[model samples]
Target: MTDAHEDHWAAPVAAAALDARVRVPGSKSITNRAYVLAALAGAPTRVRVPLDSRDTRLMLGALASLGARSEETADGFLVHPLGAGGSSHGEPVEVTLGNAGTVARFTPALAALGDSPVLFDGDEAIRRRPIGPLLTALRRLGVRIDDGAGPGRGAPPFTVHGDGGVRGGTVELDSSASSQFLSALLLAGPAFDRGVTVRLVGDAPPSEPHIAMTLDMLHRFGATVEREGAEFHVAPAKLSCPEYVVEPDLSTAAPFVAAAVAAGGTVRVTGWPSTTTQPGDWLRGFLPALGASVRLDEDGLVVTGGSSIPGVDLDLHEVGELTPVVAALLCFADGPSVISGVAHLRGHETDRITALATELSALGADVAETDDGLRITPAPLHGGVFHTYDDHRLVMAAAVLGLRVPGIYVENPATVGKTFPAFVETWTGMLGTGR
Candidate 1:
């Protein structure tokens, strides 16, 4: 991660309790899944309330490069199947994913359905992230993929050669590294002649809720799927694309929820789904444990900050994306905190554990990095220039810290554009800083 920007954001210091109702955009995860399924569907699919951000745009672009016809609609987007007699047939393509894990990992399976070779590559950080397990599974499924990192090796900058279809069948791989790999395979399962059955061979996948989301979406598209324990079976069937409306992004809503807690105020965010597979929905329980009063009423999920946020012992494996916000709150907690079962966070947009510890310590928090988590002891934090490392979550976490502590300048504040393009506007408006 590089600091290419010159100026830093002077994080707003809250003088009084903030009271606001926020409306966050649609889910990036759901939006990307809708796009992938839409491209694979036999007919055109309409996606409603899709998130318009760097990652989701990259997903749409990658699908478009693969011959999927896309058009902007009043609500969201409409994507046509690859069989629309487009230029992508038998035409080799090179798509730059621009640091989107969904585009780099998920698109390869869809690329395997192409008539010719489709090369998938991404930015510096994308190259460093592992994609070996997915590559290995693709090879077992009879897909001819030339691994660019090395023969039989993973990571991006690779090419997938397709005879216009996949010979997908039973294949096993370890998905503990990332649940996205399993979701990617299942996304392209129905198109295969034999469909696909994926069996997890090692530790339980870190975020099983994500896989659940994939299965639910697959089922909604009319695919036959069966799940028993860690194994998933997808039978051959035609996907009937329907009118889809995406839910609000719970993960992206973390910072705003944290703001209400840290600033000692009441904040209600609209469009909270009544039932969903989003892991960030766990925040309803997590916020209260951190010393906040929570309620879910007719409007939305509302949280009121307490006088003193308390420390907690938690296993954040399923909701590791919330670690940064949780860690930030722990810095101001009443006691010490231990966050465990999230070692995989090291492979995220950045080494999150190390980044959190280093930056928090620089701000005067006593942080000890464990093998799989962090043991944070509270200390008096002072103003400092907190580096973002080009990670969007890190920037938001730093911003949360700035609310209580004056003189905190967050470097690379623009990095939040990855998932939340209107992050600055939304955050500033919610904080009532009007910056």
Candidate 2:
């Protein structure tokens, strides 16, 4: 969920002999963004090898609810975009985005073009994430939006009532917080009457590559967008048929590589391209820095760990999601590792940096939290039950930690459903009874 509020359970997982050739999920980032753009374009598009996760599925369901159609085909999916008349039936379209931030933001923006108001709602966690920035952006577009419960409205069950007044205008947003604000505007460009221009009013953004990904998708949709530093320009453009395959997920594969080095085993992960648009692919570089004897072949990756690996000092702004997984690996090395460049992580599923430091320290590793990152001192970890903050990354990081120090228990093990649901079963497939 978005807000780190209310009740949640931790997942318990102990380290096991990890010797699996793991094939992780497709890219969730690419899948969700494309789904919104394709559906709004109202054109038939094919997304190959897409990630079938909770977030992406919520976006897909929103598309269908808005009159778009999707079908399972081959190993991917075929989407048929609907016209303006599709959701004009005057029925309230209820969409439960279930903690998927992409759909929660972009869908309401896209639905503003229809005659019906897109009533957006989500899970308890989604209910907590703030949408003031996006709501401000939409209202600036001349779309009628009721952004709050006001005296009576508060959380989920919020509504975006469209005035059908799509304007091409400039929205000044603070991207230092989230690229989702900019991405939402880009996805809504084709439907806006006056085109759109977004001016970022903060630092160079946390996930720069994700913004690049959004721009690339905009270009693919036949939208005319101009880039001038932090300001992006977009005009009403045609979204022609899109032919694309979803890239493999390097983020999901990071933990396995971490385990390979932590447990003194040799393991390989497949299905990643040597080249990728995802900055998370930088895992190859980061892992090696943590002392995992890493080899990147044209096909995939091979990692061998066990010896004394030195700690690393690094900035991971571009690949923040990989930090927790890599941090667990660093804990097994010889010295302290300092990682910076991810202040925005405090807003993720959990305050990732703080939560990681707490969990790692609880396991007897020396770690300290910072405003923007984490500092870790290498220490032998005696096995203990890990309280996963219901974060998939934490769950994975805990698993990697357990591999190095036995007797690890994970709470809320199901949190991996966001990316890798069959984690224990599928990943354990490789570490069979052999070693």
Candidate 3:
């Protein structure tokens, strides 16, 4: 069972079990938040294990746009703060963020702080994703962002400008657009003289876990935030840190779990700290329910995949990042599977619900989509070319579908870099293949 697209990727030379006890790079979500707050605070900051991925790169660039100096030191990245109430004035610093939702969310807040208008955008696919919730929230909070300067409406090729900087206050949002809305406002919270109290509108505020990640970084950076139901309150605060290390990404581990399930194999992933604060940690409960034999050992996680996943309908409302991986796993389930709780996926890097259904259908799977989510029935899959819609999660999750379907080919294999930069390489190694 081999997919021709597998050949397109230069097989990782050390192709083995990918079984090595390697630590995944820092959570791009956390890395971006930590970097931004550290920059805005402008204190002596030591950030260990910073991510070198596309999203993080743009975040670092956005920080540079705001006049912070961060250099590579011996251990990790050393950030020299721009201090409290710091501002910037320069040429239109064109920030090219390669589809990092966190970067797109947080950088606008940074730009607002400087009164420096930035022409910010990202990967072609990312440009199509919506940022309306944040832009609307920013405007309500007294920041001027013009999303139409770009070719698309409420899309990228946008310019952000703040008049005399921001005047933060109570702003409510219809954040069903993206969790990055709250995360963006949260990360940029310190930059404003008066912090914000956000009342996220709508019953569906997708990806609560990712928003929690933002809050964790907020706390780590020395900002005090309290969450009561749908509201998050933050006082004027600052981010200061001597050292920070990124935790293993649980999202990276999902497709691998799907593969083991498809192939009926046992695999182990190491280098995750037990006290890790990653939202993906919730996977421990969910994946096992899906039928992978899960255990937490001293080194890290060990999963033994079996033939069938219990097609128990689960709510991804709290942890929507895992939606695609979980949707792919449903393809191999024993019965009908319903993945609800995240209709907000429509506005992700792609319309994930439709994207997953469309691409999985192309592979010969029985699937249908709902406004909030989708359902997949176990069906036969054939070898065919799959379209990822340029969404990284869709690309990677579809890869798992391909591996299981055999004879699968993935176009634009480079799309995986948005989150899992080494996805294809590591995934191939795990399967004991050189290519």
lDDT values for all models: 0.87, 0.75, 0.72
What order do you get sorting by TM-score, best first? Answer: 1, 2, 3
Off by over 4 Å in 3: 1-23, 83-90, 148-153, 162-164, 433-435
Candidate 3 residues 287-350, lDDT tens each? Answer: 7776778888888877777657777788888778788877887888889988888877776777
Which stretches in model 1 have alpha-carbon errors above 4 Å? 1-5, 433-435
Per-candidate count of clashing residue pairs (backbone under 3 Å):
0, 15, 3
Model 2 C-alpha lDDT per residue in residues 1-435, reported as the tens digit of each score: 111222232222324545556677888888887777777665688888889977777888888877777887887778877553255566677777887777777788766766677777877777666566667766767777764655324345667665553875888877666677788898788778888988888687778878888888888778888999889988876687566677777788887777677776777777668776687778777666656677778667877775577877889887888889878888877888899998888877777888888889998999999889999998777766677766788878877775656566677667788877777665556566333
Compose the digit string of candidate 1's lDDT tens values, residues 1-435: 222324788887777898988989999899999999888888989999999989999998888888887899999998898766386657688888888888888888887887878888888898877789989998999898887545655877788897778889999988888889899999989988899999999988788779889999999999999999878999988887768899999999999899988888888989888789999899998888777999988778998998898888989999898999889988999899999999989888889999999999999999989998999999999998898888999988987998899888889788888899888778778877421
Error of 3 at 423 (Å): 1.8
Best by TM-score: 1
What ranges in model 2 sit over 4 Å off?
1-20, 149-157, 433-435
TM-score of 1: 0.97
